[model samples]
Target chain A: MNTNTQTTRLYHTALSPYCRKVRLVLAEKKIEVELVEERYWEGPPDLKRRNPAGKLPVLRFRGNLLAESQAIVEYLDEAVPAPSLMPQQPLERHEVRRLCAWFDDKFQAEVTRPILNERVWKKITRSGYPDSRIVKDGLRAIKEHMDYLAGLLETRRWLAGNTLSLADFTAAAHFSCLDYISDVDWDRSEALRDWYATIKSRPAFRSVLADQVPGIHPAAHYAELDFG
Target chain B: MNTNTQTTRLYHTALSPYCRKVRLVLAEKKIEVELVEERYWEGPPDLKRRNPAGKLPVLRFRGNLLAESQAIVEYLDEAVPAPSLMPQQPLERHEVRRLCAWFDDKFQAEVTRPILNERVWKKITRSGYPDSRIVKDGLRAIKEHMDYLAGLLETRRWLAGNTLSLADFTAAAHFSCLDYISDVDWDRSEALRDWYATIKSRPAFRSVLADQVPGIHPAAHYAELDFG
Candidate 1:
């Protein structure tokens, strides 16, 4: 670890998959960080100052303000070499990044964001009621995504390859959010269920599992190790 | 370059910034790739086969089917190291990736996609008539983005830093798309305009400059070296 006197802090929202991805990577690398929940929807005045993108999961580390979850995690991996979250080969590294995009770009748009926007964020922000149609669409999309993951898991131990990489944490971060709302169907695929259970049991996952968003209770089995 | 008997090919749409970004990187790296236009919006059957996410800019390189624009470009930079598109330092690299995300995720969502959807895509797909309000909103958004880029250029040589990087290509890709539809107000920022002109004059930009989408015309100054 590149030890700096400045305390590493993460500004994030509890249910955001992007924020959770950074938290998971930070924890997996065993870096101690102080977490500050940012109500980004409320649009804090300093939010844009922290990140020009005006998004959450901004990290204050080593005298640098890092934004964008993927960039931050990749920088973390490069800066902290031990317990590498990336594969050595360029081709293998591409696979890890491809899956990260799958979860962050595609899955987040299709499943996580839509579902959470309706289920969690709407309530937190005191916005309109949950749109059942949007929630249903997101629910429908998850099955196909689950099927795809199950097929990938049939061969590789981890999402990207045999070794657990950033892809696993990225995928798990999104799944954990959905799981928190009891939206995941654990019985969809035994392989995926096992994969989640394995990742969920890791020490790095402890902090995320302990997360509880105010005004919205976590699913009963969200933190259970053997629930599935 | 890792030579393989298999011919390198890129399945892409002409006006897609994501595809253009990959094309720019490929050209910048001096890699020869045969371009094949894929009408992804129509949902070609093999689109999903090439990329599970059903996205454009899938590259067949070194006999591997690669998806995701950022992943493909990063892999290219790593695989073919000469004339590197990435900075050596971790912090510098983070800046590049952060800006790439800014253009791809934020700018695309706020400015490029909406403007193109209303102006170009609707005409190409015959989906609906142009919505002036959406186009107006996108045009308005680009001003703030231009101001931000001009601010960066005031202190830095490139969008990310001193040397040209993937961030420059990514930002250029989006700007070019908007420039195609005459949506960009290059006069708004002198530094930004100079940066674009400098990048536009590169030999690597030739293929992108030559792009012609059916029934849609490029702006009079779009392909010009001294556009501003």
Candidate 2:
């Protein structure tokens, strides 16, 4: 795709689930965006100026500097109301937020951050080699999480509910990153694999599927339509 | 203050800012809640049963078990719409959510969790004495956060904006917990001090202000409305 400087821009890092979640939302909303990959670990001086928290997925939206992935996604949903990402009822919306937090916070601390820190960031940032123990712990934890998700999928079409919402994007963001490194054991939960496959086939997922980090190669079936 | 047992119930621990944020919002909405202090560290089976994440600030509200403090607060605002905590406009709402995430994720990690774990939780759990290094790090970190917040308070009446939104309550939730242990250096920022005093005087803050952990006594000026 040709770069469009005229559209809104996002300061993002490849494989950062937070950035991917926001990217998925923007794509789903059909908002034209210029993606500027940020080296967040280098701690660019301007990053802190753009976002006091000094985090990635900082969106320059219609001149407003928006930070925070969850906040950004929610804002996108509200501001551009085509294909609403949140449910209409308060309870369903609560479930969506709950699962989003489940991925962004719990699953992140237990699985994504630790695994990525050992496997990916160590390589990209030149920090150190992957700690096998930490990687094992993260891998061990993912099974339970995947099983729990499978249980949820048995009852509902989507992670949050019958309707797809931000929860899917948030969960997909983390899973896609893990999948990029071939970390996720998809066969552990057939339901979860199918759930992910369904989401991965979406048009919004194309940009993510095409992502390539310089050092790390995507898994063999990462972009394949019929991975299973 | 009577335990009605019939009104809505909240499973919470006293110094947790997440729980306090939910409590403050409940009080602000005039919803009476029975606060049940859970020994979450003990890892009760029911805790994980109620909240799959095995975290606190779980609310048994209207026959539904709600977890994730931000999700719960947003749900409350949606369910109980009188004196809405969120602004109508999407941008203002984004600001509120951003600040909430700032306190919950950034501030909690940098300051509240480390300091409280060393100073408060260690004693309550009989783990070990307060680690001065961690406490000092948390204390040192607070100066930057306080200055940033003071800058915001210099112009806006509330942390997020002119309106008293959930952002104020979310911030106050962390501040109040720190203040409970007399850890806050209130003199650092007059604007922040005044802001705290103003929010502290509200009736909604009464329950939290009165909180007393068994081994740890409240600060001399913790509950005083005009201590400054």
Candidate 3:
């Protein structure tokens, strides 16, 4: 067996919510990870070898290449078991995973992906100029999402429940991305804004907030804890 | 508090892979469910109340409405441990989840959704004629997916490991939908075909196999045990 330890590395893009989610969880668990930024859009040859899906946020941990953000974070929660990001009961856990999916799948397709594609990725990749119409639609969709989240926050301490969980990190990851581009109208919902502010203040969020992508500048309030 | 028992119910569509996944897991756990077919595309007003995301495969279990197919199934696995679909080890469990994401997110986007929308949904909703180019692209994508799955089944007894897992069911769920539409070219991969045959023979697959969407007929070999 190869006894020498390999460093825990993550192949990711800085702006990706999926990568941000994994990065936040890793930092929360206090696991040291070497973040190697991969320009996945260029279709890096080795990415396919590492993950058949050729997706961003592929983690190299404990001599294994782990793909899929939700899977990786859930595994981290299960393996490390410190400051657990998952709830104890099955029902609670279901709530956590449901919200995680809500942000990653639904929220992403509606708000994050479209906005980022038009605002950030297009500029970064030198693909095309930003389309105002697409960005407008994304902005419009986010308000409904904000209202829904505010309703949830009124009843619970965190996105999933009374306890902090992966759902919070997942939501923050998406919001942080949009916030970076100054797309979020924080004034729409106080509860949603407060929830973002609390999660943003965490030590786990430091690396994510510190991110600087060349050619596109983060919004002035993107890294502020009290911005809301 | 009222103590009368409530029936486990699922609001779903007949041809959705997400719904099939939940149905398979429920049946596998021997949990009788009332499958209420929801015409989600028509923008059912109650869908928003059931799930703010307004998606299908919403499960009403234990008096609570549960959404997201993966979350519902994972909760089922945890709540009812008998004949557990998830492995005990954290790494193994991660593998199961990774594959589930692979099928649900990646494969569904590349293969299932595009093909189904073109061939099935367009016809059912009276939206438009089938787009052969899109259908062709989806069919082409499935071959690559089959190759990947065939590679995994080369050594392992199941997709994730040596035992039946949520990964297998998740994959079968997507494949069965494609199979129903006669989109999958099963002869491309022997191992993959054998894997599907074995999983299809399970009692859990009965409900999914019986699914019939009006106006769109299932392929002749869709429900056959010895299809390969």
Full-model lDDT for every candidate: 0.94, 0.94, 0.93
Candidate 1 lDDT for residue B214? 89
For each candidate, the DockQ is: 0.89, 0.89, 0.91
lDDT by residue (A43-102, candidate 2, tens digit) is 988999999999998998877889989999999999999899999999999999999999
Cα deviation at B30, candidate 1, in Å, is 0.7
- Candidate 3 residue-wise lDDT, B1-228, digit = tens: 233347788899998999999999999999998878889989999998999889998998889899999999999999988789999999999999999999999999999999999999999999999999999999889889999999999999999999999999999999999999888898998899999999999999998888888888999999999986
Task: Give every candidate's TM-score on chain A.
Answer: 0.97, 0.97, 0.97
Q: Rank the candidates by DockQ, best first.
A: 3, 1, 2
lDDT of 1 at B157: 97
Q: Once model 1 is optimally superposed onto the true structure by TM-score, how far is the C-alpha of residue A172 displaced, in angstroms?
A: 0.4
DockQ of 2: 0.89
Report the C-alpha lDDT of model 1 over A157-226, residue by residue, as the tens digit. Answer: 9999999999999999999999999999989999999999999999999999999888889999999999
Can you tell me which runs of candidate 2 are displaced by over 4 Å?
A: A1-6, B1-6
Which whole-number lDDT from 0 to 100 does residue B62 have in model 3?
A: 88
Model 3 chain B, poorest ten-residue lDDT window?
B1-10
RMSD (Å) of each candidate, 1 decimal: 2.5, 2.0, 2.2
DockQ of candidate 3 compared with the true complex: 0.91
